[model samples]
Target: MLKDFRAFIARGNVLDLAVGVIIGGAFATITKSLTDDIIMPVVGALFGGFDFSSYFIRLGAIPADYKGSVDSYAQLKAAGVPLLGYGEFLTVVINFVILAFIVFLLMRSVNKVIATVEREKAAGTAEPAAEPAEVVLLREIRDELKGRGAVPPTA
Candidate 1:
């Protein structure tokens, strides 16, 4: 069972999947940073400094002991106030859209490369496959036999 597990882990697909997952996690972090640090701030500035992440609906009463600002979503949530954080949701949605667009562009480029290679192969512009050694040897023997007149040559 341990050997089987080792073999499964050693498979090319598993290794590729592991690499993809690690890269995907790193890419997601970059996408989130782009959305939060750059895009959201610019968008807020354009819309009269309307911060999306701070917009939330209070569902429950703030605790009496809470000392944080009432308008701050993070503070209200930390104060045990029930709230619907739709602005944060919107920010997450934007991050997802950006990541999806990047992945789409990457796939499109890969597909274009694949199509070009296929076209070259179809047009015989790609390098030809090498013949097997046995076939080459047989063809050499046939040529020698034809040259020596031991085998009939084609007209």
Candidate 2:
């Protein structure tokens, strides 16, 4: 069982996927910070200091003086205040869309590179595939035998 487990853990796909997930998680953090810390602030500044994360609807009987920041969400919830967290949701949605677009643009670039390489290959501009010796010999033999009137009986 332990050997089987080890083998499973050592599989190439599993290791690669694990590494990819870790990298993806790290990438997500950076992107999130880019959106929340940098991008949102600029966008907010453009709208005259309108913070996107502060917009929310109060659901409970809590007072309207609740400051709605990231810290405020926890406070409001801790005070047993029922609230609609639409602002946070909107921010998350925007983040997802931005990330997807960036990934799409990256994939588009990679695809273009792949297509260029393929085109080069098709145009014989790339390294040629070497013909097998047996195939070459057979083609030569066939061409030579084609001229012979004496029918070599097909085996």
Candidate 3:
């Protein structure tokens, strides 16, 4: 069982999957940064600096003893306020869309490169050129003549 486990771990697919997971995790951080730091900021600027993440609706009434201001979503939530966090949801949705688009573009480029490599490999490993039609006909005729003893078969 130990040997079998080791063999399973050593398989090419398993190793590839592990490596892919590690790389994907690292890529996710970069994607998140790109979305949060760059894309969202530009989008916010376009929308007159409105922050989507702080948008929320209070569901439950604020407690009388609550010391924190109910103005901000974070403060209200921290003060145990029931809320519908639509802004945070929208922010997450935007992040997801950006990440998905970036991944799609990356995968498309990778697929194109893979396809190019495959085409090159196929061309490089192609069979030698075929004999011309005239050559084939002449060869067949020579073979028939030789078989009928009308021509000698050359070594």
Please tell me which predicted candidate would have the highest lDDT against the true structure: 1
Residue pairs that clash (backbone atoms under 3 angstroms), model 1: none
Which stretches in model 1 have alpha-carbon errors above 4 Å?
125-155
Model 1, range 8-97, lDDT digits (tens) per residue? Answer: 999999999999999999999998888889988999999999989898999999888988899999989887899999998998888889
Ranking by TM-score: 1, 3, 2
Q: List the residue pairs that clash in candidate 3.
A: none
Clashing pairs in 2: none
Model 2: CA > 4 A from native? 63-74, 121-155
Model 2 C-alpha lDDT per residue in residues 31-137, reported as the tens digit of each score: 89989999889988998987776777778676667555444765787677887888888889989987898789988999999999999788987567899999999
Every model: Cα RMSD to truth: 7.0, 8.6, 4.9
Overall lDDT per candidate, in order of appearance: 0.92, 0.83, 0.91
Local error of candidate 1 at 34, Å? Answer: 1.3
lDDT-best of 1 and 3? 1
Candidate 3 lDDT tens digits, 1-155: 99999999999999999999999899989988998899888999999998887899999999999887667888888888999999999988988888889889999999999999999999999998999999999999999999999997799
Best by TM-score: 1
